[model samples]
Target: MASVARSLRKVFVGGLPWTVGTNELRQYFSEFGHVVNAFVIFDRNTGLSRGYGFVTFGNPAGFNSALNQQKHILEGNVLQIQPAN
Candidate 1:
């Protein structure tokens, strides 16, 4: 049997509004491509957004499309999108 290798298709989203939740993040990014998963990091103590999050795409094409945008506006905040290391 052979194992399949998948290309990296995850992006790091920063400068997110504290009010933005996982659902909102997913919804916004869905416009660019098929969002496999999206999540906003939260502070464990306050349960508030950590101002950063991650979005995963089903394929690299979607990831590239999103990366080309470089920046996005959501909830009146400018979001920084970058490829996840």
Candidate 2:
């Protein structure tokens, strides 16, 4: 239980372009804070982006900064951000 509670906070990002990848996702969110881990879900069969991703912040400040922000635009698309369930 303590391990789960200490897990890095993740933020869900939607509306990402299919062109976006892990590197781009990490780069974009780095502005908010240190990104512990960031990944864009990809279709194994097609090798294409699924248009969404997850970002884990190294600390709470980074997590909250990303979550509190009203808008996040990446790759010419307005990204939807929220806490991951």
Task: Write candidate 2's Cα lDDT for 1-85 as tens digits.
Answer: 7445435478889999988999999999999999988999998999998999999888899999998888888878999988887
Off by over 4 Å in 2: 1-3, 6-8
Compared with the true structure, what per-residue lDDT tens digits does model 1 show for residues 1-85? Answer: 1112123788899999999999999999999889988999999999999999999888777888999985699999999988787
Q: How close is candidate 2 to the true structure, as a TM-score?
A: 0.91
Instruction: Evaluate model 1: give its TM-score.
Output: 0.89
Error of 2 at 38 (Å): 0.3
